[model samples]
Target: MRISTRTSISIRSCHVRRNGPHRSSQNAWKWVASRSSVELAGTGGWLLRNGKGLAYPTPAKSNKSMRSGTLIVLFQPNEERLLSAKAMIDDGLFQKITLPSVCLAQHCVPTKGGTIAVKPGRVLGYLDSLKFRLSEGARRHSCGTFHTGTDASIIPDYADFQLDVRTFSENTQKLAKAAVERIIRKECEVAGFPTTPRMVTVVSSPAIYNDAVATSQFTRVFEWYYGRRASEVVQEMPPDIVADDLVLLALPPGGMPIPYVYWNIGVTDPETWERVSREGELRDLPPTHSAIYAPAIEPTLRIVIEALALAALTFLQLL
Candidate 1:
């Protein structure tokens, strides 16, 4: 019996490994392709690397055996601006890859380290950019040139600028946009402009509402992995930064609404987090768009990788 036992044991081992408690072949997974218009801030590239499994694996090919689901990384051009995700879709992203059972993404925040933030409902608000163009006479005679202290003599014609509006609810967004347009038209009428100040929406981003059930389950798994360090907070996003990718994943044609979780990892160091906590404000922290807004790299990268990995593993669990 010993002569033939080794072959039988090897076969059993392979079968058990493939259908192991940790392995999953039931559902496919997708990671958003990472491309950026601007140079990334501290440790921002970590998301692209870690999400693609480049950081943890020794050799890239080693991931093939363990990988059960399709991992999609969306591609974007360097010159592409807003609506990057939409560009990917229009380019046939869905047609090229297997639709995912779930989508996951993470972002860096200036909050304290070792903490996670999850808002179950309406994590992000709808965003719209309105640009108003004033005619030359409207600018000089009616609106007047914007006074710059250093350059007061500079007079401009055909003034154009963009305004952003964010709304928490979908209906509110529509109402607000319409109301804004009406108010602007009325203002132009009062100002006696030759033509109604032309209003154009340059960018529109839909609101992101996380699935309540899925978010709760994922949060539980996060806490189980990271313990008390993991907790939720309400984080305000900069008006210009919209999670459009998440929006794309949630909507139809691409696929049905899949469970997705977009979480944040704190970039500030322990020392800075403590100081800011004592001060009771984020004033000391650099604003996200500032040139000096560099996050603590090492700890931030570690936490981000851990958070993303935990979510993926939990979703792929066999039992």
Candidate 2:
């Protein structure tokens, strides 16, 4: 993709397929990063293509990189499970590509087709998942699932369920954890349980905290690019409950955390957006994970490519 500037800005793009296990992708990453230090890097696995499943593309192994700085695009393999960032790190991701000065990530949101949203500080929430198993008891209480005698005439004695808690603050997370445990125990006690319920933590991840200064800087760049449509296209939003492990990409093996920004690009089809807006039904739009969720093909991809290119240039100081 080429962006018009005093000196035309050209971005090289490439694709790497994970042939073997997860580590195979890491090896491919090493091959790409072997050339030079990555100045501006963008990593994400959520973006979709016109047909079939998701697409994974990198900005290396093309003709050559930018004259001033190298821009490498990394794809995290398991972002939905919230394990991709840590998994990549465990496979020695940083050893190949030196830690970038700034990392960037973006997701397709349910907003209007031509708009983008940016939040400065803690945008996403912390996630904690727990599994609970209630011991056999004379009485039964409501849970995610219950098991009992073979016949429906008998009362259920055992139950098990999994719960995930998301919070934006440390104090709230602590309080939530305590409250979950207390409620589980109290419910089992009230139902006359024979033994204490077993509660086990399945997984925990920190919130996605965007660097305030970097986010603000990116907002300025976006506003400048949009010009008259700046107010309509660029949205400053509040913290959301959507949680991701992308922040882990900023921390080097043993070094300090680097600055990064993870924003959202709207992908709803323009016609659908307009109809929903006209009917005041925007709140009913399908979100990212909904079964019926599908983003438009044209403007969404256009914005993603343009936004990514602009972000890379901004960090490279070529803008």
Candidate 3:
């Protein structure tokens, strides 16, 4: 099998999205460099400011490879903040490049190393993060009853806390949010508060829905590469309780929904995987986002890079 080397790639800072509008492609490209933040790179070398990164590979045959079309790899940031995708849309991402036929994303998980975890629908739950601050009026009266203050003589004037709710469906999310608000308000009323506590929504994101057809197509590529049954190549993972902002990338605001698939790559160390499995300690393995969590780098990177190339080729019809 032959692969073409001609491809184009560009890297830009996550801050660019929140900065302002991009009048032109050249103007937008200026914001690519970022020194203080971590940057993720693909197989090709760094995507420099001088337009130096390769995008995709195609078959060497000139005529056939030309039919595969150009590939554009976008490395986005701010996913932890749940605003990367929205920021890209607001910054004219589609305007700067041709609208993509499909979008793909992957994340590293604590699953056994060298395996992939994916499913066709409802990969992750919806998220609603809220911040609340009880006013001074309520705190003075409530502190005595709630025992919120350390000093016996002085009553606390205010209290603040954050709440996060996750569910698999929009209806459930709505119900949960309403219930939380009702409980908080009822408590405030019982305390004889003059004013309601301040409430602010920190995040509101929908559940990630994987396109069935797109997921199947990608699964076939994995099966072919691993020379294994589809079930073995693609782990039969149920919908995860975690939530992410990647869904925002697939469903842009005020735009038609695009086909997309998001999957998790196993990143545990091989020796650790076997040891834990043998001792029935897999349940205790450190998961993503934990302070002690760390993945074996070499094979994890190899698997992810291959998965990306295979998926790209499948979508481009170059396979």
Candidate 4:
């Protein structure tokens, strides 16, 4: 086999519908060819490396020469809880597999059908789940009585449960954490508690900053291909919704500093999208994470496949 330089690509998805055809994988394999392969047992992931000895013909190719690159696709499970990604890293995912030069991921949103939305700079923010515990006396005395009149009694020891904080910047994340801790401590002091309230972090995920140059280049390409179907959204994202995969890729072990792109594609049908568009709000739309929230599958799959294939080909040309 001929030895050639390899460019690694990584694909990750939070959720994959069961019992449906593997449209993305099939389209990807058909679009790109490779000589060597490695599969992750039970995860349904693949690592494909293309060398000079093997040729994968594409529309861009003039001759029969093969392109040099590697593509690693990772399908993450347990998307609802967002825990499987962290588990994979702890198990040494990047250490065992080839590291990608750049990482790419996309989400299905409730926007108008065929629309692609993206933004520069910080595409997502940091997410942290904090828990606060307070004794019965602290709660009753500081906040309020459990009941009124004769029925009034001290509240049982309780915790604030899960308080989620999303910060757009690292500095903001630090300030938010500190402010939360300070507020809890002050409440305990005011309640005359013998000890300070306990604070715990249930989960923490960092923010993602897209590379400016790379983002601009891709935005033009998307607009050129999709025209009116592509857009750049200026609205802020909800803080509690953490993008764990991109955050994990930005950190150690993975340590990929190259440009990373995170974009959104609409999953709603044309009729529903038109209705929501006419209404001028998403209140009528089924929001993500809701039991009723379901995306139109066929169109979604086709759009996603096309976007991924185009992105891979564009990046390969640069290589």
Candidate 5:
């Protein structure tokens, strides 16, 4: 290292060049003299220019990268509610929710940006939430007061969203239809599906979603496969229909009990339905409670006794 007469300086030192901060050329020779040992490892403390500290290397697999995605669907009024329900079932979302999948009506909210899917067990909740966004498609579905100023506004455009709920309801209904049929047929143990056909009819075509589509679909599916024909109820079809969930058999004319199906696949034949209602003081019992219980022991015992008595009477008459 040397200094020019004009006072500029030059130094030959890659260490200083690589490490920087040689002060001035005046100490260049001094450093070279002491340069006996100065080795650097790839430590970030290279020149130590940054005393503020540095960041450690982070792993590539962050939580943001691994988090599950959320899904939401938008609805236009004309489309049936079941379309989304079916989409979820086909994709297995209800399994994710772990609830009895039903044809529940949904309301959409076009919020800050995304639309939220609001599913209330009862149709009223969905309707109330839908008002959050005034949809161009929401027509005929009036929300207002009725005569006497009674708030009859809750009754929705039954048709408007009836189909929407089919996705949830009919899926359950389809199950209900099969279970009721089986209970009637005496194929399955009564403990699982002890409801009468009368009660079963009421729940499947529940007054709420009981439009022509829901009613006829549920009734047709159940009756065709396992119910007794006319000589009993209205027009009847042959009993070749496919029955699932449980298999039912044809009842004697006016002999079949109505069936009631709950979302949980809990079922009730009519006699059991009445017994449970009269048995329990609580109206708040879940839809599945009666369906889960054994047909009362008393009733079964009575039937057995009656059958024995009839047999003895028949024997005596024959003699």
Candidate 6:
């Protein structure tokens, strides 16, 4: 893909595919980052493309970067989102939005009127992980993942997490996986995407996960991530191709329900949710990292649920 004049911006989308090499048929698209919000870098140059996927390389310009974000929910990206992203010379969306947040008790009620007497922050914790390459900041988190789709059946996804899993092997893995499961289901059950923002590189990578779960945990992680039995979303979201950042979009058909429900939960680490501070008394603690896995479909539903619930409660009080 060539843009003669900077004004003639044309960014083509790439779907997820196999690990195989780029085909001769694949056209190269230029991704030039903006030096200033109003400026474009690649006035005349071939944008770099390699194993790392697509990028709009910008020259060292103004010392600052514009990290604007957008969240959108649509069946498919209409032309506008793509154009908006390209026009901005986005670094990459995957890296920009995948952030792990504290899982607060939003919808549920005051359970422990008779509920378990667990300390606040102690019984509730959110944990996730990310692994990357040997690029600029490759030593730590990756520069964002490859397009979820490649030569193989292409698909993509993303989200974020932070958990502390230590002690017995089973306990750590189990609790970690449980948090992931609840999140995906709840996300699919509650919220959604932003208005529609482009992507960006992290400029740098921090140690994404010194406490990343072992590869053995892949199956269990996949199960919880999709809120389905293992391999449920495998065809589209294969495990091997997954990288640091995941861009999942849940649009059109407006929203949907989770076909899977939690029939039973294994023994949960009663103390897993406790929040720990570096200054607080030290105790034997397990390693942890943020898991940013964004699934477009579920999060959208999650947002809808929250909105509806608030509306309902407001209506009831009126009566």
Whole-structure CA lDDT of model 4 = 0.54
- Which of the two candidates, 1 or 4, achieves a greater TM-score against the reference? 1
Q: Rate the local accuracy (lDDT) of all candidates.
A: 0.53, 0.65, 0.64, 0.54, 0.24, 0.23
TM-score per candidate, chains pooled: 0.71, 0.74, 0.75, 0.68, 0.17, 0.15
| Candidates in descending lDDT order | 2, 3, 4, 1, 5, 6
Report the lDDT tens digits of candidate 3 across residue range 98-153. 65678776777887777788789888999999988776553433564333566766
lDDT at 312, model 3: 67
User: How far off is residue 59 in model 5, in Å?
Assistant: 51
lDDT of 6 at 302: 28
lDDT, residue 293, candidate 6: 14
Question: lDDT tens digits, residues 130-153, model 2?
Answer: 889776744334332354346655
TM-score of predicted structure 2? 0.74
Which one is best on TM-score? 3
Candidate 2's error at 223, in angstroms?
2.0
Cα displacement (angstroms), candidate 6, residue 150, comes to: 43
Q: How does model 6 score by TM-score?
A: 0.15
Note each model's CA RMSD in angstroms.
Answer: 14.0, 9.6, 9.5, 8.6, 35.1, 24.9
Tens digit of per-residue lDDT, candidate 1, span 1-319? 0000000000011111232221121211122222211222222222323332433222212455665554443323221234556666677766776666666665566776655677576676788889888664524343344522234455555667778878777798899999999998898788777777888988788777766776776777876766554443223323333434456644547356665666666777778888778888668788643445555644654566565556655555510
Model 6 residue 1 CA deviation (Å) reads: 23
lDDT of 4 by residue, 114-177 (tens): 5566666777778777877765544424544332223235444554556888877779888999
- Residue 21 of model 1 has an lDDT of 21
Off by over 4 Å in 3: 1-67, 138-157, 229-232
| Evaluation by TM-score, superior candidate among 3 and 6 | 3
Candidate 3 lDDT (Cα, 0 to 1): 0.64
After superposition, candidate 5 runs with Cα above 4 Å error: 1-218, 229-272, 280-284, 287-319
